[model samples]
Target: MFSLYALAQQAPSIDLIISNCKVINMADGSITQGQSVAIKNGKIIDVHSDKYIKNKYQAAQYIQAEGRYVMPGLWDMHMHFGGGDSTLHENKNFLALYLAHGVTSIRDMAADISKSVVKWRDEINNDQLTGPRIFTSGPKLEGYKPIWKGVLQVGTPEEVESALDSLQKLNVDFVKITENTLKPDIYLYALKAVKARGLRSSAHIPSSLTLNEVIDAGLNSVEHLGYAYNAGIPKAATASKASQFNAEYAKQQYRYMANHHVFITPTLLGSYIISHLDEDSHTNDAYLKYIGRGIKNTYSWRVDRAKNISAEASKQRHENYDNVSKILPLLQSEGVKIMAGTDAGYLNSFVYPGIGIHQELALMVKAGLSPLQALQASVVNSPAFLGLTEYGSVAKDKRADLILLDQNPIENIEATQKIHSVIVKGVVFDRRQLDKFLKDVADQNVSGL
Candidate 1:
């Protein structure tokens, strides 16, 4: 048997070690103090008491966390990358914005730039690019002559199958079907077909169908909260030909959703922006400094439409937003898993990509979720949405996608904004480096469309 010193020296070396920290246990909203987390080859190898790690292990690099809070990096579940080639470089710059703000992963809903987005996703995964881990839906499935560009238009079951076949070839993480004139019956067919092919499916529920109707047809996640709000109104079943939205009925529907394991991305921040556009013009939003001219141009369509609405229409928009936003707490109370998404990206006015997720968390708390619950919506719920078991928490053997905050986020969700450091794939970026990422993006000067 070797001496203690010799045994300690024989231990295998790791790449990085972070000691003197408070690790947030996302699983139960608890905090483990005085901890040290170890990483090797881009995965967490050990997370133990600080003294234990400091005395027993060695690494190529060591970061003194200095009692800061560590938690899993955030996920932005809904965002788009589009605007054709003119904005390609500008759009690609959004990646740096995400990392600077502690967003380690994102779910890119399909846009016109499917092929390029796919390549970006691959490159990011292979460590060839600097960006969040991207899981894209490729080109969304829609009907012929759909308003949105870069979609697989399918009018029949055969067409739907062919589109899915193409998506399969692309090895897309999941499938996204929209309501842009896609026949309802065929939409249901596509959902079933996607399930049969062993794929997860999310959709923009059409007004003609009740929330319950779509859930029964194998829809895994609802993209936005507007449709669910519509389903909860009294006489919804009779007037809109969908289910009712009353509390008792809502309880039943939520129970059904929990049993079925369907997820919801309220994307309340986007709705808030839409409802209050008339009140807050966002002309001076400092975040605009980072948005490209081409992407800023995309905002005009929505803004112009919002500007043209009458006072009464604007009030109704506000009322609609209030009603929809209120449903967020109800979903949480009923055991329905919520994924925090910003609905951020091109064409969604004022919803910036990087910082939008923080806004989403704040809104969730305002809508009645605790800070822990709100954090869960992004860090915990998002991984489950993708059926990925390796991420969403700070634990041994987990991917080293995490953020170190100067303040405790559990005390206030806004503390997340005080990012002290970020670790993506075991690569550490301290405060100075994070600011450099932001500065690099702003230097693009992509504004002034």
Candidate 2:
């Protein structure tokens, strides 16, 4: 029942109010303290010293931010929510879970179920859901055959044309193309078609395509760092002709991406677990409580498989993860627009959806990204890359997608876990409220009684 119109009437009409925040404005490299932020409806109406705002405007409800660092609620760009129907039901709870953890928006990278997600997107805009804003590819585009269910399979040039046309009719948020599942030629054709329809195209870069081919085809964005690595290989130009997924051949793809202006997500944590999962027991993970039971059973098979791999091969994967860690800083220095996305899902085992992102940020920090820079990867940088002008920053006229933390995240990125409050779509939830929501979910999910 709470929409922007309903919330605005109760908005701050008062002059100066206090939020007592340690602020991180990733926009201008500004970090300040004891400041107050003002709100009008769901947009940040003003942000000034408490006294100044108090004397200037009349307010209705004053949020006592008290010793908190107020920053933008996060946007996780690389999320997916379906392999089958059970996930569609779970998607409703998924939104609340993200919001509970301060994620205000999510870009789904193609779920098998499209109808519910699209409906969820519209309903969230209409204030019908209490979760993050959903932006989705709806379904993935593959070639020759639909290796996964709910895909828009394009086998030839005409099929590519038809799929592109269907995207428009379905009115999806973006386009997601996978590599191994499709032929590069027709996939490129589909990318061109996406552009012609005025939609942004992003994909798991086919190792076969050179970085130049991707940029030349006008790819809107590339999804992961591994893909960028392939593009770095000079012979990737020839790989497209032969259609091979040889990472070693495309080793220096980062340089090509930097030169040609392509973006990479580098969902390191998800990759970290997937590639090196055999290293740790899922039951022993620090954040295991955050994983729901339904999802935890799915993780056992992978962990069991990890136990059989040679210790030497396992050691090599750890080494690869360590090497991959360096890409975060390298991309930053090369002027690559890196956005934080967690390929966190049921299939990805151990990388729980909500908490895995915090782990991802910590890994990025270990790899030399400043805490400020890492926050930008999740917040300001993500919306900027997605061209979402209204939601990322905590500024006047920006949507009220803000999170208040007990500690300054710039000082320690893990301070993100000390969440105190979150304001999503103008509805505010303090720590107690969030705790209750999570508890109720846990009880209902576990007991169903």
Candidate 3:
């Protein structure tokens, strides 16, 4: 038998230990109770029974989870940061808001402030700043006179080549292409080029081209559900018709997506909010206080446009949301990877950052997903889609980005919002500190700094 001195010498010293927690295994939705996690150098060094870990290892800091649920920190796969130069400071404040809401990572799907976003991403990675881990597409690719601002306009194949070169130089996480003003042919060409370079590409499918064509051309992901909905209908069929929900067509489309490994970020929460804006103006929402005036002003454009919509059109919007949301379950059933993204940020009225991921999970459950499945979308599927091997679970050898909740989220998705503490890169922020983060953002917003 080994001596106690030898065993003690073998035990590793760790930076932090979270004991007596129930670890939620995102991979299979199982819960391991009375577990302890040992973290060192921002990675989980060990995870085992609380008694075993407490007896073996020593930690510099300890958090008695007291039987709370511990799971991976949330990832918002599709969000933005842009309201032009005037709202740059406001956008910066969103970082704290994300941490306050237990979001450990975010994917910025292109915006006007590409340079600033890149700097912030680097700073956060280097631990020079406090914010969620950022993976930005830099500036998205568009066409001549695109509807949106701050895009790389590429009309010809040569211009597309130039755009890709620029994006590669900037070292963007992925390539984002929008179809607002881009020609259908160029869109396909850009997708092919991005594929040839071995870079993942996400985009809006042009109405002129079928989803199959885009996927076959090497499109990695579809940003919104509308495109997937459109794919389920015949090209000649009117998309506005209630008859658009063809089960056979949808099954075939979803099956193709699964086979090809094309991920989909439904972003259902934003659609739900906009669809029901007439019923709840959200003027008195407590979350609004944290949003800067400049960013809030950007909300008016969409709000004004919604006010002009006729009652019949408003009803149609509600119907459209319901119809599209129903397919979320179908997508999951068919083995399609559905990533949870809130589409939260500037220009998207009232879809607040940070807390938006929790709202998105709840909406996913409402749309027929199990709470565990919805949690997987944020913590599991997101990292898988991004090929991040270090994240997405509460286990040894994984990144120590986690959330401690008073209740199990698998029991009720809303429990995710009941965060007791957040740990990013092995750094813990208790409830009090998280609340302070929110308060500071609110104070900054009020001061317009």
In candidate 3, what are the lDDT values of residues 1-449, reduced to their tens digit?
Answer: 56887887787888999999999988777899999999999999999999899888989999999999999999999999998988888899989999999999999999899989999999999999999999999999998998788899999999999999999988899999999999999999999999999899888889889888999999999999888888888767765545966878889989999999999999998899899887888889999999999889989988998867888988998998999898899999999999999999998999999889999999999999999899989989898887888888888899999999999888899999999999999999999999999999988878878
- Better model by TM-score, 1 or 2? 1
Per-model TM-score versus the true fold: 0.96, 0.89, 0.97
Mind giving the per-residue lDDT tens digits that candidate 1 earns over 323-363? 77888888888888999889888888989989999999999
lDDT value, residue 202 of candidate 1? 83
Best model number under TM-score? 3
Please write out the lDDT profile of model 2 over residues 141-211, one tens digit for every residue.
88655546678877788878777777777788888887767888877887777777788888877766767
State the C-alpha lDDT per candidate. 0.89, 0.74, 0.92
* Candidate numbers, best lDDT first, in rank order: 3, 1, 2
What is the C-alpha local distance difference test score of candidate 1?
0.89
Where does candidate 2 have its weakest 10-residue lDDT segment?
240-249
Error of 1 at 172 (Å): 0.6
Model 1 lDDT at residue 248: 76
Worst 10-residue lDDT window for candidate 1 reads 235-244
Clashing pairs in 3: none
